[model samples]
Target: MGWHYTPYGLPYIVSGLVALPVAVAIWKRRSMPGALPLSIFMFAMVEWSLGNALEMFRTDLAGKTFWASVEWIGTVIIPVAWLAVAIQFSGRDEWLSRRNVALLLVVPATILVLMWTNDLHGLMRHNVRLDTSGPFSVITKDYGPAFWAYVVYAYTLLFIGSTMMMRSLFGRSRLYSGQAVMFAIGVVVPWVSNALYISGNSPVPRLDITPIAFTVSGLATSIGLLRYRLMDIVPIAWATVAGGMRSGVIVVDSQDRVVDVNPAAARITGWSAALAVGQPVVEMLRPWPAAADACREHEIAANGKGARQSEVVQEVAGGDRSGDRSYEFRFSPLLTARGRVVGRLVVIDDITERKRVRDQLVTQQRALAAMEERERLARDLHDSLGQVLGFLNVQAQAAREQLSRGKTSLADGYLETIVTVAQDAYEEVRENIRTMKGVLPADWRFAPTLERLARRFERSYGIQTDLAIPDEIRDGVLGRAAEVQVLRIIQEAMTNARRHGGARHIQVSFAVAAEGVEVVVKDDGSGFEIKGLGGGNGRVREQDGVRADAGFGLGIMRERAEQVGGRLEVRSAPGMGTQVRVRVPLRESEEKAQGRDAHEDSGR
Candidate 1:
């Protein structure tokens, strides 16, 4: 096998060399969509060009024919590979299944076999001979029906692939449009060269310039790879990811013009994507003034020096015919490799359901607080008013009995006591009503409220009330719920001192302990035995004028203390004064905070 070199074949060698690096570059990114097929396409171009260059250097007919057959190997693969790249790049990868790809290769594979066995059948080429052309010896042949059939098949695939790339020119970003334009040129240049060669219209006879034409195609792809980052950022993947998202996505350029809007964004903004592109972003987002203002603010911040990519999230409310809806808008700046701001990306997420659930939880909490308030009111009425009414009944019967026995002076005394007791009950009823109405103001101070309660107790019961609270205790803060419970406990203690123990004087003092504030209420009165009060039920044997079950107020006071994360203790013995102590933690527990919130709700 002898070979001859000519200057005419150098361009093919250069074309083959130029395509080598492009093929390797694309192969490196083969994991991306369309990359594998595009790399295969470039590899096929390399084989065709180099094989044709070798065919031009071969002097003998057999050597030239062998290289031409080798060139046919790449020739058959190019069209099918190009079609596959188009399908994958256009986001139609589902169509490139194994069975479908195999079907696509059927005609190319058959043509190659027929060309190899054409000596016997004359179906691929007939009357093949070596033509010593202007600058080199090249093989020339008359194509047969089979060769024409392959030509038609190859052209059909090229046309389809080119058409798909052309469609990407409109309604796409400048990056994608530039990539599509380069691909379209790559596909069309080779097609036109092949057509000229087939029609015998080539400038040089018997030399197919189709392989040389591929140099232009390879250069176009290289430009796309470098300038537009075709393999790195595929537009079809962007479309599939952003278009199918439930959240709205909008992209704007540096000038605040709408570069792209996904379908979800179009629905959210009530603007069509086709019409929204190239419009001013401020005008497009006019319906949501807050969102528009956020975009403007982000753009201004992004333009500053050393500005890095950051996301700003804010909740926005919009009203419609049904009701108000909430949405969370997330704004992020789009930056270039040089850290220059290029645009902004906004994502809108609907949060109406979340807001609705939150409001429903608040409503349920208020209802629960109302129920708790009613229960507290019931306990207060039983502890104070019920006991007063019972005393009035007993005193009225006593006065009637004295009058019937002709003890006029004793009856008159009983009447005077009844009048005083009636006035006290009236004041007690008014105080209970004020408590039910949540009379504790928002800025209510613990010491002042306690002092006022002591004064009222002194006036109602004719008992000398002494308060010995420290400066720290007076200045300390307590949650409204805990404060209310503490005051009620003190009131109950005072009442027990007067009624049950027949106390004359009551002393209330506070001391700061290790864990919290400790309150002590002492009375100089006829104290009952502390025995039989172990079970929190407040059951005790009868002592003095108090009934066996008259210790119910003690049980109620213990419950109120526990509700506010506190503890209560009572000490008493016969002929000794009664002392009630309560310890309340300084820091509110989770349970206590919830109770405070409930108390506020009831107040509202």
Candidate 2:
């Protein structure tokens, strides 16, 4: 409010230059937490420094006191601004409501009112005089109760604000530690300097050097702004999100040291998230192998490009149920603007429920397939055997009546017809029994079982069957249900070759390929013409619901494959040999589905 020319104003000018630019820098990023408050604090410093410089250089007593009062505008408000900065920076902004801010303003407003009207009460300045103190005109003031009260209020606010910033500096991420240090120096310099001056311990008598201290504060905070981008954000933001997340999150530096861990991660590793930080994640999770691998950032850090994957089961505590929740840990490179890998961020998602629901769905599908299979078999019997049995009953009754009328030849003929019908029904029943093979392979891991099946077939039917299943393909592609379906498809193909194709040598070979798990069943037997069968292009499509009346029809075999989620292909010619190739795509590991398959097949 008051200005005077003075040589001591150079320090104030320098302080203004420093504080103003820092203020603008922070103001530009005012949307960030603590930025606006920091800007306000910087502005207050500019006002106080410039006003004090003017007050100290002025020789006239009235002008000295008036300009000193002008300095109150910055002095009264500095603490409030600092407190606001601390509150917002420390993630405690919810306490800073409109009412609280209005209340905070009241103290500074009252202090300003008292300072301007001090001439009436003499309570603010008690006694004031302009004196030549160390070659500079300084305003010397006798102590007043109001001025002491203001000192206590200002220091109290400073203490509270400093505590907030220090708490985060010590407890939060180390990345922002430098910024915190600079910020503390900036705030503390003015506090100590003012306390000394107000306590009558200033280096120069009758001169308040508090404004000069703002120069140092401004310089310290300016360094923080330029070097650390202070007030833009704090490392606590990362920890805040990581801490509150339901999914486990673990962050590691480039050196693979654990930098941050969420509570969920601690729950998984059985180590405290707070204490585990700054330790090696590998060391912390050594007791649990699966979880250790999940938290390990070494490989991802080495890769530098990040990783892409689906899901994997990471057991927490329990067996394969609750305590043993599934987690899909995704590893990504934490990069800067220049694409530098500073660290790796691992996001652990709990997928236990997803796996459980998927297993339940598969189980339901299998149940539905079983029910459909039963219905189809029942319908076949009703349509053929049921009618045959009914006809036999009628012929038997007719034969009995013919015999009762003394027509022995007619009764004998009816009996013969009954015998003929019974024989036809017997053949149809045999055919049905021959076509149905037990529900493929029961287990998802079917290499051993398939080998056993081949051996059994060779022994029973006098056919030389060789199984050439590779190791990788055995436990690779397709889920449990699909594997069972694929096995059934191959089983039916083998049966068709023996009964219809009259195959001599049957070879079952499978290999893991890029496309998927490829299975081939080749028979050097009397292969039938695929074109002549309804499977060829000329015939009605299976989608059209046209039933092929032929030997060993593939309608049911194709349906079973589709039901279990697989693709089936039957390639054959007149005598070139038949190749039943099945390519089942790979499925992401679903432990729940695999376990359910095992449970269902335990009886088999």
Candidate 3:
């Protein structure tokens, strides 16, 4: 069981065998994004192969020459491996702009020149010596200057690469950072130990310790790589995602000290992430009096509640002056593997747009209530006033008839004139009431309402209107609100056809699908300049900003349709009649049928 015993080879041999299959599996699976780690693994396998070869050659002449060649050939491999690992780990490969690509190509060439000339000769040995009683059958010079440069170059790449890797891995599942650290130590420690041995530093009695250390580092790294997926998964990397979001996120221990904050958290909270790392979470976030104090106390009191607590919307003052920012502070406990809560996660999302939408909804609701009131008053006057006028006309007619039947000498001129005036006034009032009712129909079913509207237009404006609607739509488009919006939009289009487009005929067609809605309205009438009309998305306003009579109808239809998350489309031709089509989404259950149809279509 001594270091030189064959049993000592057990670990290296086992690790090498195990690593080969795992590396192959990883290569075959190809789940990871970068190709460099696979390259590093290839290098490791080569080194392992050489080590095994050297061991076998210990008692043979040809084996000795092979080992000598193997030992000196690092001139080509080490620098290449270092450069590859550095580029991959730095995450600069993906962003290799022209400028960076030039650097990438050049840096290695410089390193190679230094290696061959022994200028960077500090890292690789120019000579080898034979010795007895050492771990190998031989030993080499300390080669201080050469060794120092070698150590410096290798370690500098490692240290810089690892720091960047850890930063990229942070806040990911603890598995990520932990694995990265493990891999880094696994590689660096052994390499450093070997350097120390080369310098004649006494620790393990012989250079044979390099293999043992290498075996340990390899085992540790292999374990971590398998467990965490290391460079194997295609993702933004937890550290990169957490660092790049616009919201503030904080992780706090039970003691309330801040354990983590991303760059976004720092920018929003006005605290440098590095400086805020160990400060109290509450102090860093510092919500107003009640919220800040409550967070600390409640977090401790709740202990391990699996609930996510949220705050009432609060205005965050002082930042960009776009408007007041309202934040919804969400608090969820961070739990350990065993389900015990270790800490809490705080996420602050800017809900300013949500607040603005809510305010707009309130204003619209008030306007709707006022419109309803006006409609109610208009209806009341129409019904009551029309009946009163009819009764008065009947009475005047009766009086006039009675006076005519009586003697002509008894007829009063003033009475006759009064009767005539009252009859004319009653007729005018009746006509006004009819006009006030406008043109809405009593029935509102889809097909029936459409038929009624078309007939009314034919009779009133002497225009032929044709509506082509299928009996049953494969995709259902008629939610209550959507139905109303569709009807109103049609009504408006018909009005426009008569008043503006001067259409002779109209056709409306609708097609609906599970994913979305489509409506086409085509009209042949006196078409105006379409460009001058502005796109449909623009607000239709009156000359005085009160909304044009035509514009009002369009606005109401658009608003109602948008409320139900549907859309309205209007199409017209200059002299041709207009056709309008309306379509809306079917529910998820219907999507299955639609998908089947789609699949069948694709098959065909």
Candidate 4:
């Protein structure tokens, strides 16, 4: 059998016929975010299929070569268009800057130039002739490195472009995944058929079946446009989400390639947004090995371990930031409605200031507490000893008057009174010192401390004292503040009985009642006039620096009790007796805290 030239057949005519409207439809929606690139792809397919059909029908070498050059226009650009589609579909249109697009054009333009000037350098084809061995007339040539170079470049685009498209499909929403699935099918059909042809392993070896394959691709793309409305999702994502974010956000497919990274994400991670796109997550995070590891682990858990609902928290320390900084990252699975894990969404928040503020708050609280302690000490000194010292000066002056009146026995008794008051005041100061050292906040322990005060009064003044404080009072029933108030009140009452009222016996007791804890101190002694020294109200005079405010002790006691939501009563009369009573109330919650503290102290 003899070989002959073949003309346009049923397949070639049909492929060209099918591609025209599909190209127009795709072009019509070019204003969509990703559709511009898609339109370019469909248009290239129209040129390649139509020109290939015409070239195959031409029965002469000159006619076939001229049509082959026209076919090469789409052939040279189809891969570029496919790459652009991948870029746009993945929400990375930022990568296609004018400079990068021009650089992409450079190689393909050179290839087209070489094909046009093939007779001059024969770089594209070393020798050319009309092949009569196949059913269709086609140009046959001994191909050069330039021809192989074009082959290498096209396949490179195909492989990388397909990789990006597949990643786009993997972790997308249901509607998006369906549209991407169709786009993937559109992409795969031509490559598979072309690969078979280039390797001479196609089902029809000499027949160029790529155009027929492209026809199928165009149909699939058309179906995606009509069925899923792929174009609408892009503007929605761009306008509302991707552009407005302040926190660093990154999206990655199961392949771990960065499918999308916002400006904030790129800046925070120290990568250019355009350069970072299509890069492996590991490579982008190389400066942070721990973060990189976490990124890989989270993706694995999300996609493989079925932890689609789980999130991974990673703390990243230090970066290209101006000062010391920390960022908290939260990585979660991007899952479809069916619960299939598709991608990972990583969010980064700067937490350096938050940590610093927390530390500052703790320091301020400690300093404020110290300042309050010092203020409490100052107030304690003024209330207790200041009043006692002034009273002693008054008693010493009275004793001198008695001696001038030639009553030596009365003067000796007055001298003894002054000594007892001074000794009690000294002991009170020592107790305050111990309280300041460790007891804290105000040292109001009523049990042994108050009982000791009563006993000391007995020894100093030779005034037999009666003391009865319950076990609960000794176990710190009152807060330090409350304890100090009640104890000081008792000390003042005892001193006044011996020094002013001339009492021989003083009794102190604690009784619990429905009102609260009640402390009563009574004395059988000479009672002073209550009218001048706060008969009921705690009003005291402050003047003369020596005998000023003789009733200041009574005033302080009353004020202290009232401050802690407690009450104080004073009863005294000239040459009769004196009795002091106080009631203090406390919250149940404070009582529980006291118990807990006591238990902890006991353990120590």
Candidate 5:
């Protein structure tokens, strides 16, 4: 059985056949990612086939010279091919320099030259008897020292290359470590067989199982490549796109089983996350019955093996895990490589906030339209109706003078009274129109606009009204809304004092506070029952902490307070003064003013 390479031939043949399919697959793939290893595996399988076939007919080769040429060529090419494969497979091509190729060629060329020259140099070969114990007398030649020398060079090249390959492959943790181990075994086993034969311990035949095993290694690595789609598989890429989408996704099979659910899908569905593997997507998603119709239509389109979509916005009812949430949904059909319909993929997004804002804006638009209509009516009444009433009051006073004599003058006084009543009626009409005109810019920044108001109150009303307000308000914290509220509060207090309390003194003060700005209006007036007062004329009155008023004046002030996250306080008692105080949170500059006040108070 010694020197019989027959059994080893089977592995080479099997591995070679396997490699054919794998190479075809790789070629079809179109990207030769690592060209050298793949090419080496391919060529090595072919080289092994040729070498094994030649070794099987070694003895008969001499009788047929052409056959002998083939054997000789196989022997020579096997070493070179093995070397090339090992160099490439182990990634030692960088070291396979031009100098190394030239050096390698020298010995083979020398062996050829010596064979042509009749072995005179005596290094290339020396023959030995092949069989001593057989009657057939097949005189097989033994290998010469040069042949052993070639063996050493071949083995050294392979060993070094394989070792480097192992180191490199093992360094990569993510790659096929098992394939690397198999290749190492493939390399080592045949070397052990060769060693045993060289040591004369076993008479068994030594054919290089390494090439067969190397082919097996190639097949294993290729299978790993195909299965894992190690670089990038099309299906995996598409699956990733489906999984990583921003909108909620749900896929259901024909049997209505859930197949997949993405991250966004989890948030919108409002159900304790259902695995998409085997649940009805409609049942799990809680889609309306109408959605099935849209899905059916889309599925019918998909029967043609083309993409189809159904864009539907549906407000799904709340599930057990989530409260209320709105969603915009889209359903599409999944497709396969051969353009076959797979299943439905449902895409959805949570649009609750968008709907909420849209509703608010619609309400605001309606309110704005009503306000514009009211403003137009107020302007009409002020320009037309108020002027006519003023002219009527003037004409009544003139007629009262003409209707007078000495005793008739008493009747004229009554006519004068009628004139006065007419004037009062006209003024009240004007006042109503003014109030209906809404809060004005002058009233809003009353600090700057109050000069004439103060003068008029002092001259005509005969009440000393003092105004102490800064010309340039530093902190714009006292915005127009806040300022209007403060001004109205002061005006109301002043009016109450003049008409009911007969107040002769008034003072208005505006000052920066530690936490906010403060406005105070105090008047020396006969204060009425604070509790007895209704939210008088729909104006603000305090009960507990909240104000009781439906009038726009107090409502505006309260709204301004709430807007700035501030507060208002009113203190009044009968037969004493009344104080109305407003506190508006200071911005940075006013806060600095507050800090200075605190420092001054501390120093004092």
Candidate 6:
């Protein structure tokens, strides 16, 4: 059992030692997808290298044969471990089921048993002897039937694993290319080395250089682990992430050809990946033409000179057996490392539930806004027309009382007052009806509408109404809602002047300011104290020397101003005329729009 140190066997020893740390490093990252199996593969390489090295260093034939048998342990494990690494690395981990693993181990396990029992049956190897040919002694033997059977099984697995590794070279990401190249070299070098040794074409006679070949394989794997970050950034198979995702992912090349389609995409477009790939994307996505057109247009733009297209997102509606479904397709360009446009990545997200929720919320908001408008109308009627009607009823009662007392002149005066009150009430009713129809004209001609309103006011109330609207602020300046609100505020001001302040002359003017449009309604009427009006709500108490009903109108006008991102101000004294100035911004704020929408939702 003596052993001699052989420089020829030193390379195998160095390979085994070098592989030890690599195997340990991979084992430490065993939590990663392919790390555990890869670590096992490295460990098998270490055993096979070291065991062969020890066999070559042994002097006795029995010692050499014993070490050769020991080498079979790693030899038997390498193929299955390599296949497992390939499967896990390619993201086909589901194929490594317990049943499938046991089945894969069956042949390797049989070969191991036969190898250990080879002395009894000689099915693994025979005619084993130590040959001191060339620089060192090496074990030589004629591989028997069982050994050749294991060769066929091991080669089959290695071939499959090599094919999987090669397929990763053509993946979408450039990051995986380097890792795949390293893996290919690692798998192929050892495979070719073994074939050369088996064919007796080894450079050293009777010397198997397969273990030394593993040194090259180990070096390739080490480079991949260090430089390419092999196990850290795994190259997942298409089925792993893209196929399992709920969103549909479609990859189209620059020529508008469908390069890849995930399972979710297949289900969405009603075309399998096999049928979709290599076909024209426009034709493949004919059912979703909007998505196809988006991809095609982006590709066309990308291919054009000086065209830098951005990502596009569009929502499309498609009907299924259940009902209509909404899908949002996002098109993004796939650029290579050199900044060249290679393809487009289309991601389709099913947004049916989001759309349904949004529509329902919108309907609810509309219903709430209608109800709020009705309530506002009811309040207006109670404040203006109802009071007029009550006064008319009182005057009629007085007229009847005077007639019953035989006071003809007094009754006649009361009758005339009633007629005047009834006429005013009729005008107020018509005005309310017009206001309820909305203040903005069908054509949205702001200036003419304001002029018409001023003229109508002058005719109806016998007041001299002057309008000084700027020629620049004629049309298309304000949004429709802002126009409606502005007109309503002006109308409210004029009505209050005639009904409450007994104004004989009213002037409405508009001025363009740096911020926005400024509207001023000045009236020569008996103005009340500005302090008489309450805060924003304009709810004046009886002690405030302002009619509570008048305060309601002021509050509404202020609210209208605020709705258009504006402010309302009142300036007045006991002897001076009152001035209502409102400044509305030209541009709407997002916060203001959201607040208005929320207010409508809450029916406020």
Tens-digit lDDT string for candidate 1 (1-604)? 7988887788889989988998898899776556788789889989999999998888999999989998998899988987887776565667888899999999999998998899989999989998875567777788899999998998899789767766644457653567778877886788788778888888776679987776677668656755665544344434434578899887775566676788887877787877887688877667667777787777777777544756677777883321377887887775433233446777888889998898899999889767755765676577667766777788889999999999999999888888977886786576567776877456767777788778767755578999977776666555567767888889889978877788999999887765677788999988877775647765666766665654667887898899878999999887798999988876545456779999997874
lDDT per model vs. reference: 0.76, 0.68, 0.54, 0.71, 0.53, 0.76
Q: Give the TM-scores of the predictions, in the order they appear.
A: 0.56, 0.53, 0.51, 0.41, 0.32, 0.51
RMSD from true fold, candidate 6: 13.1
lDDT per residue as tens, model 4, 122-232: 999867887877666667889998999988888898778778767656655442557877888887888899889888998976877887887787678677765565543
Compose the digit string of candidate 2's lDDT tens values, residues 1-604: 3445666667777776777777888788776556677788888888888777676566688887887899899988888987987787566667688899998888789889999999888767776865664566666678678877887888888789878777766665665567778877877887788778768797765556776686677667666756675543344346345477887777766556677787887776566756777677677656556666755434543553333222233544432323556656565555432233445666667777887898899999999868866875675566446766777889899999999999999999999988866765675465346437533333325676567667656643567998887767565556666666777677677866775667889998877765567788999876656655555222322221223332234666667666755567878766777888876665654445567899987843
- For candidate 2, the per-residue lDDT at 337 reads 27
Clash totals, every prediction: 0, 1, 17, 4, 4, 0
For candidate 2, give the lDDT of residue 94: 70
Residues 361-438, candidate 6: write the lDDT tens digits.
999998976776687678767756776677778888999999999999999998887787677667657655766776
Error of 5 at 358 (Å): 40
Count of backbone collisions in candidate 3: 17
lDDT string, candidate 5, 245-319, tens digits: 777777654444554566777766554344444455666555445454455555556555435443334444345
Give the per-residue Cα lDDT of candidate 5 at 48: 53
Model 4 CA deviation exceeding 4 Å by range: 1-8, 231-604
Which model, 2 or 3, shows the larger lDDT? 2
Name the lDDT of candidate 4.
0.71
Clashing pairs in 5: 130-140, 258-276, 258-279, 259-276
Q: Select the stronger candidate by lDDT from 1 and 4.
A: 1
Local error of candidate 6 at residue 215 (angstroms): 3.8
